[model samples]
Each structure stands twice: as C-alpha cells, then as structure tokens.
Target: MAPQGMTEAALTGFRQQLTGDALTSGDPGYDEARAVHNAMIDRRPAVIAQCETEADVARSIRFGRENDLEIAVRGGGHSVAGMSLSDGGIVVDLRRMHTVIINPESRAARVGGGATMSHLDRATQPYDLATTGGRASTTGVGGFTLGGGSGWLERKFGLACDNLLAVELVTADGSTVHASEDENQELFWALHGGGGNFGVATAITLKLHELPAMSMIMLLFRPDSGPEVLRAYRDFVESAPDEVGGGCIYLTGPPEEFVPEDLVGKLVCAVLITYAGTESEARMVAAPMLELAHAAEMIAELPYAELQCMLDDPAGMRNYWSAEYLDALPDKAVDAFCARSSTMIVPSGTQHVLFPLGGAAADGPAHYPLPWRGSPWVVHPFGTWESPADDERGKKWVRDVRADVQPWSNGAVYLNFIGQEGDERVVAGVGGDNYARLAAVKAQYDPDNVFRLNHNIKPA
Candidate 1:
C-alpha cells in the first residue's frame, strides 16, 4: 500500500518524473530491491526509485517530502544497522548510478554515489592506481568514505575520506551543491566523518596513489596461542612501516586448501599482514611472526584488488559488530581480548578482530572529526553468523568485547564500525566539539533533518 498521505495518482506522477524504474509493493523486484546486506533487516519502502541521475535523486527527495513520507537512500545497502532502507517510505536507490570515471593523468577517480568498492577498484587497478577502500568489495564508496572509511590499506593511504577531492550532493530541497576544500568548506569538513545526515551524494572524486604491487601473509595458530600471538603482533606493528597494513582475527577456520583438516570448522587464531609493495618486502617485514609455530600459512604477492576480496564476508548473513579504539594494547588487555574469543559463537562466520591503526592514518589531518585515528590499536568484535538462533548470543558477544576493553578505550569510536549505539556514543564518535560544529553545518544544509536515518546529528 502507498503511504497514508500518498495517493496512487501522486505516486504515478512521481514515478513519471524519474528516468529510472520505481519499485513499489508487489512490484516485480520489490523484495530484492528492499533487501540490504544484513538479513536481519526486513523493511518495505513504499517506492524504491532506482535513480539513474542526480535529477532523479532530487525528484525522489522532493516527492517524499511532499507526500509526508520518510526518505531513505540506498547505495551498496551495506549499513549494518540497515539505515539505507525505510519502512513504508520512499527510497532513493542509486544502484543504477554505479559508474566510475578514472583520470590517470590527474591521479583521481570520479565515482558515482552508488558505486561499490569493486567498481572503484576494478576501474583503477588497470592504471596501477588506488586509494583507501573498505575491506569488502561490495561496500558502497560514498557511504564508506563519508563515514570515515577504514580498510586494509588505511595505514598506507589513510582512510578513504582522506583521499576525497570533491563531492556532488543533492540537498533536501532538491538542489545540487558541490563541496571541496575550496567550495562549501564547512560542509566538506563535515563530510569527512559526519556520514549522510546532510544530503544525498551524487558523485565523489577521490585522489589516488600509485600502487605498483601488493602482498600478504596469512598464518593460522591454535586458539590458545591468541594471547602470545597478539603480544608479538603488537610489538611488531608498533614499529612496522607505513606500507604494512592488516589485522589479527580469531575466526572459525574455513575449509580452505591452506587450512589443515584438523583446524577446519574449529576456533582458530589468524594473523594477516598486508604489504603495499612486493612479496620480498612483505616477508622481510613480517619475519617476526614467520618464526612462530603455526598450523598453516600462505604467503604471496597479489593484486591490490584481489587482496581486498580475500576476506570478503558473504552477504545476507546476520551481522552484529562493535569496536573500541585503545590507547595501548597491554599484555593484560591482550589476555582479556583473547579470553572473550571463547564466548563467540563457533562454527559460524563470526570473528574477534584486532586492527592496528597508526602510520598514515594517525598522520592524516587531525582537524577532521575522526578522533579515533590517533589510537594505536582498535578491537573490533565482528559478528557474522547464518542463523537467527544465534542472534542473541552473537550480539551479547560483541557487547562483552566492548565492555572488556573499556579500561583501555580512548573514549572515541569510528561511527562506521557500529550501529546506532546511542546519542552519547554519537557525540564520542565525532568529538564533542566537532559534533557541535557538524550540527551547525547540518543546520545550514538540512535544518529539517531530512536525512536522519544515519547516526543523526540534530541541526544546531
């Protein structure tokens, strides 16, 4: 059914104004159109406008407002909290707008709002150029970059937003605006970590760097070795070069060729070291962990794009994850982090992860709202399972991890790593003062809070 305030004639007129197809309830692809990355979210938007152009985005926003309907924007639909979909509202679906234009000379790429990491990576891989992107290829560049993107290469190239050159956005009033260092300066600053509380981004231009080669080291150890392995990993990463980037995770061993049959389907601790250069350089830098006893290992140089897909979590799984940035990873803390691994759901896709953040990430602009950047390490309890029966257990394990590490927390977090934690967490996500400033910018661009589905910032 159409929203209470919307009539069939109005819906038809709205659909006519779009160059893209609109999917409503009972539409051929409505079910698929409304589905997001998390299977836990099941919402039915009144109209799913698969926008093909910026004009379509503007029209969809206007139609939603005119009909007193909530407006949600869908890009890769990767929000763990399912913020991209609205129940019985209008959805500005930009999947059809996935286009990437690369400029080798300028060393940049103009990515459509709906473009995924795969779209951006594949386009720039041929040129041997790249930028910081989400770990998953299916993640939307716009949402990831705007929410302060963190990925495997963050230590090398910094977060995705750090590479942002400009953004083309359609405001709540159905008008276009361009933000960059030289244009709409305040709004541009907010885009660094403020998320989509301002407007719908049509296109984003990102600065790219030359990436000649990439390599990785994957070593699996017994779950009991987590504390010792993490301690060694911590000591090595403290002085590791900027070219080094990766994470340590405790996950259910996958049935991979490299994984021993005894370890498969069992709780195992793995350490991954991704190097931005050649295999030799990666091996020399990772020599410390190489000497440790291990059950299995894989070391090779691969394409940067290929490395990004290696750890891709399959979609349509139940996911509940949270993170805590730490001032330091002391041995006691490592013990606590490792101990929580026992509580995690086994034989599922869940992972207890630890990512070291420093290098280029810590060296990036300190003025941005990403206060967590300065932290030396971050503990992420990434819970992804296949069964609803495990939902309560999965969510509790994530919360427990956060609680376990509270003693070392820097009191700041990356909003992109969490769901709607709370109003207080939102304040901490973006620094207290930064939140005030972001709200002022929010007031200028979206005073009515038209884009409140995300970690919302009320207009000042």
Candidate 2:
C-alpha cells in the first residue's frame, strides 16, 4: 500500500527526479535502507531518499515538506534515539554522499556530510594531519561535528566544531547556502552546536593539525579497584598536558589477545591514555596510571587513524546513552560513579566511562553554543545490549548514572552524547542565551521547524 499522502504516481515521479535510489515499503532494499545503528529503533519511513548529491538533498527535503511528511536526515545512522529514521515520514539518506577531499598544503579537509570518522581520518592520515573526530569510527561527521564533536584528539586539537571552517547546506526552503566565518555568519555560529536544526549539511570544511604520531596506554584492573584507580586518574588528568587525553572506563572486558583470560567477560576498570606523540612520551605522561597494578597492559604507538577506530562499537545492538558534565570530580562523585557499575548489564557492551575535558576542548571559542566545554569531567553511561528484555534495565542504568552524579553536574551537556532528552536538556546542551540566539537563526533559516528530529532548537 502507498504511504498516506503519498500516491504511487507521486512516489514514482520522486524516484525519477533523484540520481539515487528511493526505497519504500515492499521495495527490494527498503528494510536494509531503513535500518539504523540502534537495533531498538525499527521505524518504517514511508520513503527513504538515498541522496547522492547536494541537489538530491534539496529535492528530498522539498518532497518531504510538499507531501507533509515528517523529515529525518540520515548520515551514519548512529543516532542512539534513532532520530535519523521516522516512523512514517520521508528520510533523506546521505550515505551515498560520503566523500573526503583533503588540501595538504592548506591543512584542511572538505568532508562530505555523510562521511564517517573512519572516512575522514583515513583520508587525512596519509598526510600526517587530523582533526578532532568522534570516538567511534562509524559516527557521522555531520551529526558529530554539528553537535560539538568530542573524542581522543579533542583536547589536543579542539572539539570538531572548533575546527570547522565552512559548511555547505540545504535550507528548509530547498535553497542551497554556505555558512562560514564570512557568509551567513549567524547561521554559522548556530551550526557550531545547533545540530541539524537549520538545514541539511551537504559538506563541511574542517581545519586540520599536524599529527606526526599517536600512541596510547591501556591498563586493565580489577573492578574492585575502580574507586582508587579513578581517583588517581582524576588527579593525573587535572595536570596532564594538552597532548594527553583519554578516559577511565568500567566495561565488560572483551576477549582480546591482550586481555587476561580471567578478566574476559567480566567487568573491569580500565584506563586508556591517548597521547598525540610517541610511545615513550605517552608512557612518561601516563606514568601515574602505569604505577597501579594492572592485570593486562597494551601500550603502543600507532597511526592516528588506527587509534580512532579502537573504540568502534558493533552495530545492530540496542543502545541508550546519557552524559553529565561535572564541575569537578570529587572523591564522593568518584565513588558514586564506581558504585553504579554494579547495575550495568555485564557481559554486554555497556560502558561506564569518565572523560576529562580541558586544554583545547575547553579553550575553544566561548561564544559558541556548546555549554559542556568548561566542565572538567563528564560521566557518560553508554549502555548497549543485545536483548529487548534489557531495555528498561539499560535505560535505567543510564538515567541512574546521571542522577547519581547530579550534585556535581554543571547542568550543561553535549547533545551528541545523548538521546531525546527533554527540551530543557536541549537548552542546557547549548546555553539558554545561546539557545535563544540559535532559535532566531532557526527562525531565519527554518522558521517552520522542518528539521526537528535532532535535539531540536525551536525557531523564535
């Protein structure tokens, strides 16, 4: 049956106008095209327009609006809340637009809106250049950067938005526009952390930095030692240099060769120290965590691109994640974080992670919409499981983690790290003042709020 408001003739005409495939119910590739990274979200959009170019993106948006279909944009399909897919709307899929062009001399990369961290990283790695990218390889550059991108290299380079040079976008009216330091300046500022509220980004230009080498130290300890280990990790990060960045995590130990047989499949407290320099420098900087007794260790110098892929989570798993930015990581907060690990579904992909933000990440432009930049620490409960039965258990664990550390919370959050939090949180993600300004920008570019699937910023 044709979707409501979508006639067979109209659907066929829409397909004829696109250079890419348009899949709908009962279509050959419809199911696979609609599947997002989060297994829990199984929405069936009336139409999934696989856009291959900027023109295609504009056409898709116009078609959705003209037909009164809710519009969702799909880049990497990694939105934990599945905002990229709509239950019965039109999805403007940008996966086919994944292209990366590097300017070696200028030290910049013009990345396609649909490109993933792996795509951008690999393209720039050969030139010994990189920018802050998402923690996972599969994360979409569009959503990540637009939502204040964070990652291992963030402290050294800056959040991904800090490196943004320009963005080519398709606005609500199906018109193409460019946002940069000079063009559409207000929209550009909003684009820093405003997310996909204004339009569909067809391409984004990011400033890159010279990254000659990258190294990391991974130390695994017994779960019982989490409190003590986290305390020390906290102190270490407080004084760690800009080149040093990583996280202390409590996770189900994977069965890797370096992982001890006893620790595998069990919850373990592990500290990862990522260094932008050599292994020697990394070891020297990470000496504090190295002193702690560890059951397993892996310290090596590797390509920057390879390091970016280390935390790649497998797709097709149920996911629910939330984060709390903290003004400080007091000992009490440390204990609360460790205590909550017990509730996490073990033998699953759930991770109780604590990342420090300082140096370049916090030092970036203060005028942008990002509110989490100044917070020194962030407690991220990234819960991933394989069963529907664990849905409540997983979600509760994430929310409980947020509640546990609410005392020290700065009330600011990174929108990309969370999923469908209320409007208040959306305001908190970007400061109240910034939200008002972003809404005005939304009013100018998307007054009707055509793009509302993300952590939405309503138009003024």
Candidate 3:
C-alpha cells in the first residue's frame, strides 16, 4: 500500500499480478518513484506500476478498477500540475516501455508511450527523419501528441496530433484495440487532440519527414524596446513564409557562464529563430529582427536536435504554464505584452513565448476531435522558480500573464500546457461543441471514465 496506507496482503496481491517493477511507498525507491519532473509536486500513490508491455498496462487498468482505486498514467512525468498521481491510488507509470521502431523506407516510426522526444530524435535523426514533437528534449511524446503537440516544425508540417498514423489502446474494459484509418476510425479521430480521456495508448505510430538543414538565430534586445521588438516579431510572422519558425522569450538575463554576472537578473527580450532552409536563407530571414533595436546576438547554425536543447531550463525547477491561441497579434496586444514583460520578476526564471502556428497547421481540413485549428499564433507564459518559497510568486505571474492575453485570445488553450484548473478550463480547452462530441465518443468507448484524470472528459 501507499503512505496513506493499504494492507500488506492487498499490496502482495497486486505485486503478484505485476510482472514489471512494482514500487510501493515503503520501498527504497519510493521517494524517487513519486517524484515528477516538476519539483513542486509531491504525491504518495499506493502503487507505482511501471508497465513493460501492453498486457501489463491492461492488467494494471483492471486491477485499479477492481480495487476501486484512482488511476494516473504517466508518460514523461513533466506535467507542471503533476496530474499523474493521486493521494492513495494506482499510478500506471509507462517509463519502462521506451522503444522506438523506425522504418526509414516508410518514413514512419512506432514509438512506445514512454519514449521521450530525445529518444525518438536519437532513433530517427540518423536517417534525417523527424516528426512534429515538443520543443523540449525530455518531454514525453505521448502526453505532447495526445494534447496536440505544437513545436518548431508545426508551421512546416502540422500539429503532432495530425501526424499520428495509429495507436494501440487499452480501453476501460481491458481490451486492446488498434486504432487507425480503417480499424476504429472514430477512435482514431478522437485520439488526435483528444487528450488522454479516451484510453491508455500503449504505443503510437507517427509519420516522419526528411528534415532539411536549419539555422537558428538568438537575439536579445533591451527591455525598453520590447514593444518595438514584439511588433516587429508580429510583422515577421505575418509576412514570413512557412519555412521560418521561431519565437521570442521575454525574460531577464540568465547568469550563464558566457553571460556577464551583472546582467544575470535583468529583464530582457530574447528572440529565437529556426528555419527550414539553408543558413543563407536564415540570414535574410533574420535581418528584420536585427533592425528592431540594439541588443545581443547568439544565433548560429546547428543540428535540429541541438537547437531544441539550447533552450532547456534547469532541472528541478518549479513552473506553471498557460496559453492562448491568437487569430491575429494586434498592435495593442503586442504593446500590452511588452509593457508587463519589462516588469517581470524572478529575472532568469520567467519565460514568455509566442508560438508560430499557421502554414501547415492551418492548411489542413483534418478531422481532429479538438476544436482548435486555423489559429495564427499560440502564446504561452512559462513561469519557473528554483526556490520553493517562490511558489506563489510564480503561480501569480502565470495567472497574470494569462489574464493579460485574455482580450486578444480565443479562449481555447493547448491542453498539454494546462494545469489542474477545473472542468471549466477543460471545456475551454476543447470548445463546447467538440467537448460534446468527445463526450459521446467517450461514453461509447469508456462510459465509466476509467481514464478521466487528464483534462478529463466525462461520459456524456
């Protein structure tokens, strides 16, 4: 049993059913098993069952149901809210099933649910094949794709959800089914951008593309020039072609080894660039950004995966994120963001981004269950802190950033970035119409809502 307490007999019975590692709260690995990527979270689940195969996932699901225990499925455990654990329940951890099968001839890869972006990238990079994945190297492909992954290649290709070819799911009844275009097409549709409400996906097949050589540019401008900088960014996004994908980080200077110590905690604006063309083209593409104002330039040509790691935050940092999809980045909105951004506290820990999402993401008439499509840009306010005492400060910063963008936003957010707000935010993630349809599908496949923990979609 867990810290809250369960009987030894019940725990032994559960262990008997598990072929993979079964860690209880009393075990030596207990504290580490309960720890998620976000240090802010600390929950004690009764069972931390790491599944080795699809059968293990199925058995765990049934076991949790039979025992009347709440279930939390964890992929990368990178969630800011730490929704992958309950007070005293079963946690079906998918970390042990890290496998990526790449078929270069077909330009597709079948990945285990536990595989991280780094795992998939390492497996596919040798062939120069890539897919729509998260920006961070360690983010879980499962949670990111399930919530409609948006990233550096989104405008060139599409949402990660759109690239899904098929998935192996363990339904509420413990039956395993393959979902794709022909077999269970309805289930396939729900999987794209539906969050993790439908079922537990043991494996996913994704379509990959030949990645062209890319050059990224990193520029930092003064805080006073934030408004002009953001305005220029908006113009660049509006006029730039699909080949260019990048965003700006509004934060203070970080005390990296290369940066001077005095500039470490000062408010600054950072603009990052990643393009789908050659270095020559990236230079021309980055010219306008240079003209914005006086600042520092740390841009260069690098491997696609290398560029992804350049922005990685320090490990063990507490953070919260909120997002809004914009139809257009208005001048006033740009000014508003710049105004508050200059005053951002905690300097190096705060992050603000404007994700480019158009060309490919909006070009398709794809039948994804999620309502969001055709959005011009996605804005995320990523708040982070190294100290535990800064918890409320970080939370308030995220909340305020979200509030500032409300006027220009369309309300629907990227579910992957959302925290444990409430059902209202869940309904807001997928619009009312889409939520209803998802609910109906959920009722048909999972009437009891065994998988209701994630941006939960209750049965209709």
Q: All predictions: root-mean-square deviation over Cα?
A: 0.8, 0.9, 1.8
Flag the better candidate by TM-score, 2 or 3. 2
Cα lDDT of model 3 by residue, 154-230, tens digit: 88888888889999988888898899988998778778778788888889999999986768877877777778888
* Colliding pairs, model 1: none
**Candidate 3 TM-score versus the reference:** 0.95
lDDT of each: 0.93, 0.93, 0.81
- Clashing residue pairs in candidate 3 are none
Model 3 local distance difference test score: 0.81
* Candidate 3 clash figure, as a count: 0
Tens digit per residue, CA lDDT, model 2, 1-460: 5687788788888889999988889989999999899999999999999999898999999999889999999999998999999999999999999999999999999999899999999999999999999888899999899999999988899999999999999999999999999999999999999999999999999999999999999999999999999999999999999999899999999999999999999999999999999999988888888999989999999998898888878878999999999998889999999999999999999999999999999999999999899889999999999999999999999999999999999899999889998999999999998878888899999999999999998899
